[model samples]
Target: MEEQFYLVWPPVLLLLLSLGRRRRTLVLGLSTVVVAASAASWLSYRTPSGGSTPDVYFSPVLGVVPLATGCVLALLLDDERCRSFASGLAGHLGTWAGAAAVVGVQFWIGDDWTDHAWTFGLLMPATGLAAAVLIGGLVSVRTPVSVALSWSPVAWFGRRVSYSAYLWHPLVIALLGTFAIGWFGNVWLFAAAVIVSIGAAYAIEVPVEKLRARVREARRLVAEDHAARSAAAS
Candidate 1:
């Protein structure tokens, strides 16, 4: 079941590629139908072998409905005609509305969030919708609170180290537990994990990216030099 998670990429790639080849309207329609259908029938899906975990890869039905929502959002946002429209949409989402949205999501979750199966079940699509709106607001030409959020040093630093942080977070949590320190819920534990994750990002991610850029530059120079030599010889 763990291995099945990797299976998602191939289908997602195929779906995205298919959408890329289609007209904007067609892609929107297709994505809408997919997300709607997946959400509508999400409740009926059962886990394999009576396990607690729901099988994300539901064979004919894709696991990530919210992923479809993201695809639609991407399609809309990437189009030149959509640029103004997206900006307008973002400008309309004021600070008050953003606060209200957060409250609504929290209220929907309630106290016993984990125990509530539907909350967990519907979370992905809900999160996708919320993220789409927030992202749209941030990237919009005219903004209010989103502008502040974008400029905030905390957000800037998190964005820089986020990928490596993601990679290390689970391992950090596990190590803390093994060492009898603390679990994920502890603030101190999270702080330590974040520090370690940031260090990892600085040590690994930055270096790898720099090396990749240098390799690309080297390849380009080699190609140009070869062309020059050929031209000179001729």
Candidate 2:
């Protein structure tokens, strides 16, 4: 959750900088430079006795590099050639293989690898690129993989609850911990967290969205009525 707080400012800054024409190029170049600088800074000060201080993965300031890199990759995907390349790569390797490769590399490296500067500086961007390619590839083409992802039940539910899930999952996990419910295993905990988060999100967000829609509808009717009166007078 602290990571989520740290993540907020970088994307906002990227969004602000992304305005206007030539945005893709501008953002890509800017993000590249920022990522390079972050890596360089890590390399300069990193010691053999690795520790978490000045970590790029979690540092409020340095964390921007990964977010910015994501922005850059997303922007690149907007280009037809880049999207085609991604789609082709996924198509050639097969979707499952591509996905497995990405997951396997991350698992192989392990989480603590980031404690060392060399691995963090090198693998972070590399893994980000791999993930972007797989995701971009999946959505860009009309394969079984893409079709499954676009299936209404899966897509709509995810769109509606994903943010809520992200916000509420930590609380649900903490509550479970407090109750000492996690002694069973992580699988049960994860299942419980997901169920609770989705339920909570729908309970809150659905009503709020309905209210917002009603407000907009009211505003629209008022404007229409005012326009009709002006036209009558004229």
RMSD of each: 5.1, 5.2
User: Could you say which candidate leads in TM-score?
Assistant: 1
lDDT of each: 0.63, 0.67
**Could you tell me the lDDT of residue 169 within candidate 1?**
86
Instruction: Please give each candidate's TM-score.
Output: 0.70, 0.68
Candidate 1 lDDT over residue span 25-76, tens digit each? 6566756765665565465555345333444434334444555566666677
Q: List candidate 2 segments past 4 Å from native.
A: 1-24, 37-56, 80-98, 109-115, 118-120, 175-184
Distance (Å) between predicted and true CA of 233, model 2?
1.6
lDDT of 1: 0.63
Which ten residues in a row are the worst by lDDT in model 1? 50-59
